[model samples]
Target: MKQDSFSGRATQGSFFEGLFVRSLQASGPFAEELRACGYDPHHPKAIYPIEVWNAALEVAWRRCYTGWTREAAYREMGRQLALGFLQTWMGKVVDMGLTMLGPDRLMARIPSLLALDTFRYELKVQPLGPHQYRVSIRNDPDAKPELIAGLLEAGLGRTGVKPTATVVMHREQDFDIDVTW
Candidate 1:
């Protein structure tokens, strides 16, 4: 089978899939469907085909949140994922760093973290002004602006800054996020 546009390393995919499944399980329903989609939350380093993962997310979201739009659900999932990350050892380190250095410095570290995480896309961080930034993602066909926005918002929130993220551009190849606090 042809792979989907969005693919990540086994470790990255496992982390996300585990978080997604656990979040769904906590809310009740759709956990079985997620597993049926070929993801096992118990295995944290297994490889997942992005196509199956995407389909599973869609199915789980549709079943669990019949009234919510995909964008909204994804945004909320992203937010929860950010919170979930904070619960991990690396996430605790990141949280401590963000708390100490504040959002601007934290923003500067995002690209490195993303690279370390082995995400499918490349991240570029540009400063617009004090307390403002333009974040660009390249080679992202899935257009995950909501997820990016949510993560940024949560990161900023950690630094005691209420952030506002605007999707300046969202296309098949790239996306631009304008973040201000």
Candidate 2:
């Protein structure tokens, strides 16, 4: 498995597979299918989200459960889960005067985590209170406000990067962000 792509750090395979497999091990509808199919929950390859697991299972069924044929399925599972992690738990929005950290660096840290080679993003910073400011992200220019909020929540979390004193707004073309450095 690969990790820290930009920095060229290798990550353990167990960490990659553990994300989803751990969920299934907790017990659910998906586990029953895997058991019926004779798949090993303890196997390193079984460590992906239920959705990705289902996709692989479909391909596995078509190929008659051949272990050698699962490589593509596993890769696909990695892509999906990687995207989820990137969009969910990375980046922080700080006050404008906090050491000049900008949008590109923030986006780079995130998209790179997913092994995404290319992506498009836009960020806007506006001054508000005496020591407060707003940093709005229009990730997709065509996306509506609701979508932006969803992205913000995923990329920066509902409470956002500062976490101490911040406001997150989701509105198309006109969103509000409050922050105090």
Candidate 3:
């Protein structure tokens, strides 16, 4: 079996569990599907496979976000995660520091930022313009591009950039997101 790679406070028994049920409610109806999957947000595992994480998102997409396109629903769920991040003291402190960097710099910092939560991935940001960037994720084809877009939209929005992030490429274990303010 492949080694599990995804981590960070969200995957481990930390901030994510606290915000998960609440985030589910905020994003849509309660996530009864999660419980059915043996994922009790209140007493979550210290670690689980990324496939389970994907399944949880799939549950949210199908059950909670009815009538929405798959990508749209994933994006909305990502935004909810960002909102949850902000409710934490650590996240609040991080946001205060992030506020100084604004969107452009923040986009470039994707790799380092993600390292705090995920692993076994390489992300690069190339500037297409002073206010535009192309973020490429390699080495983990299972990465969710649209969900990343939603995270960017919410995080960059905090800088008042009104940013837009679109998945422009996907081939095997690589994808790119084009981001602009």
Q: Highest lDDT among the candidates is held by which one?
A: 3
What candidate 3 gets wrong by more than 4 Å, as runs, is: 1-10, 13-15, 26-30, 115-118
Q: Give the distance in Å from residue 160's predicted Cα in candidate 1 to where it truly belongs.
A: 1.2
Better of 1 and 2 by TM-score: 1
Tens digit of per-residue lDDT, candidate 3, span 1-181:
2234444323543335534654655232445556655456655566655655666778778777899999899888777777676666557876886789977778767777654244567888899988899989898746777888888888888887888888999788788999898
> After superposition on all CA atoms, how large is the RMSD of candidate 2?
13.1
What are the clash counts of all predictions, listed in order? 0, 2, 2
Q: Candidate 2 regions off by >4 Å?
A: 1-19, 23-29, 35-39, 46-104, 116-152, 162-181
Q: Tell me which of candidates 1 and 2 scores higher on lDDT.
A: 1
Clashing pairs in 2: 20-48, 145-172
Superior candidate under TM-score, 2 versus 3: 3
Sort the candidates on lDDT, descending order.
3, 1, 2
lDDT: worst 10-residue window of model 1 = 1-10
Comparing 1 and 3 by TM-score, which wins?
3
The stretch of ten residues in a row with the least summed lDDT in candidate 2 is: 89-98
C-alpha-based local distance difference test score of model 2: 0.37
